[model samples]
Target: MDKANQSQQVTELTLAGLTDDPRLKGPLFVLFLLVYFITLAGNLGMVALIRSSSQLQSPMYFFLGNLSLLDACYASVVAPRTLMNLLMEKKTISLVGCAAQLFFFIGFGSTECFLLAAMAYDRYVAICNPLLYQSIMSHRVCVLLVAGSYVLGLLHSLVHTEFAFSLPFCPPAEIDDFYCEIMPVLAVSCSNTQVNRHLILGLGGLVEMVTILAVLVSYSFILSAVSKISSFKGRHKAFSTCTSHLTGVTIFHGSILALNFRPRPTDTLSTDKTFAVFYSLVVPMLNPLIYSFRNREVKSALREFVVWK
Candidate 1:
């Protein structure tokens, strides 16, 4: 069909759950509910803990609080919808709602990728360039980095959403996997999705690759610097600071790579669902725990607060 005709063809779509088996519904609901609750509590708790603790007033903690907030936001976009689908019979979303989900999912997710890179740089400065750490990461500089990450995220999401919805959808919008994903959305489109698919592959796929590259490059330098530390105790402390950042990076980028760049879509969806669980649910829960609970300062603050309470 021509562009004009395709434009006028259709706009709405029907979505399908990954599995229609009635037997799986109850188990999935219970499992996802538990995951969602832990993710919410872990991320929200980290934000609150950071804010209340005076010792965590540095740029590191500031970035951490933002990271936790993004995790909560990202998980909220996907997890709750997934949970609702399991419980509800209809499992339908409007075109606008789907678009909104796509926008925020990409937005927060892109932001988290950049934020992870920024945090890696922060650790690099603190560990590798200790003398310039404070001077380089001043409050104003920190704010600018965080703002830039969000702006980049917004732009990326806009590009993906615009191209995604431009295609025509005759019917059958049933998105498997409990949320509105781009692949499922494109699958039911009446018009040929070659251009839309290429756009997603070029824009969204390339950006994710770039983000992963940036993260890997930052950590490479971090690892080299950590290895050079003379004292065993000093090296241990340095590596500990990076442990949480590394954990978060591994989960987020690893899942994206698996789901987006896989060899076959049909073969990957089941595995993709598992990757999605890691990215959207498990990672959020683990990020705060890895960072907050492992840090001496946060643990100390928690203890002091407990004693005083």
Candidate 2:
């Protein structure tokens, strides 16, 4: 077949969404709708709270606010489409639409990885070098870090999306996952995808490893500092400050590693989907709850804002 004919043949792809069980659609839709609602409310509420409250003007909350915004964005990219697909008997997505989803999904995800690493570094400075925290983590520095995260994310997504979409895809172009994820979409290509597979492994692995290493190193220093504190109350206080962030790191990295890093049989479609749900849906909702409930200052600011309103 000529290039034009092949392109015409695969102009649109179908999404084999989460499940095909007719009995489960209603319950799953209701459940996913509730989750998406909470994700929006929690993430938007966090961002609004951070922006409105003078008490949250620090670098830590600034990063947290950006993280919240990203959660909302990436969730929106996938959740609405997933919800719509649930209601339709024939779940179809245009080729262009799939590419768009892949781009934004990866862009936001990679940005979040770097942003989380930046947050870890922020915690390290605040805990390990309290005296120098203000000077080192200035407003200008925070802005640059956040900007760099988004920039790197865009570039990373561009490279992967371009390369992935360049491969010729023949018929039976149905993606097994709910969304246009890298691996699942690549699985549909007719051309030789060994290079693309290796790239996914190499590039994706490098990004995750570097960001995770940064978080680990930062926490190592933080733990060392906490251990040296003379008073029991001081140690407890230090640990409390880090607990929420540590929890966030664990959940985010753990889910991604399980999905991407682990060796998988080709038949583990259901398992991959489960991991995707946790990181994409569950973690975003959990992040705001963790930060807001754990931090006294955020609670106080929320209370103050409520009363003022």
What local lDDT score does residue 255 receive in model 2, on the 0 to 100 scale? 83
Q: What lDDT score belongs to each candidate, Candidate 1 first?
A: 0.81, 0.90
Against the true structure, candidate 2 has what lDDT?
0.90
Off by over 4 Å in 2: 1-8
Model 1 pairs whose backbones collide: 13-173, 14-172, 14-173, 14-174, 15-173, 15-174, 15-175, 16-174, 16-175
TM per prediction: 0.91, 0.96
Compute the lDDT of residue 14 as modeled in candidate 2: 83
Q: For residues 1-309, could you state the per-residue lDDT of candidate 1 as single tens digits?
A: 464565464444455664678899899889878988888898888788889989888899999999998889988998877877777777778788899998999889888888888888888888888898999999999999899999999899898888888766653445666677777777766668898789888987777877778777877888899889899998898888878778778877877877777787367567777766777677777888888667899888878778888
Candidate 1 Cα lDDT to native: 0.81
Judged by TM-score, which candidate is best? 2
Clashing pairs in 2: none
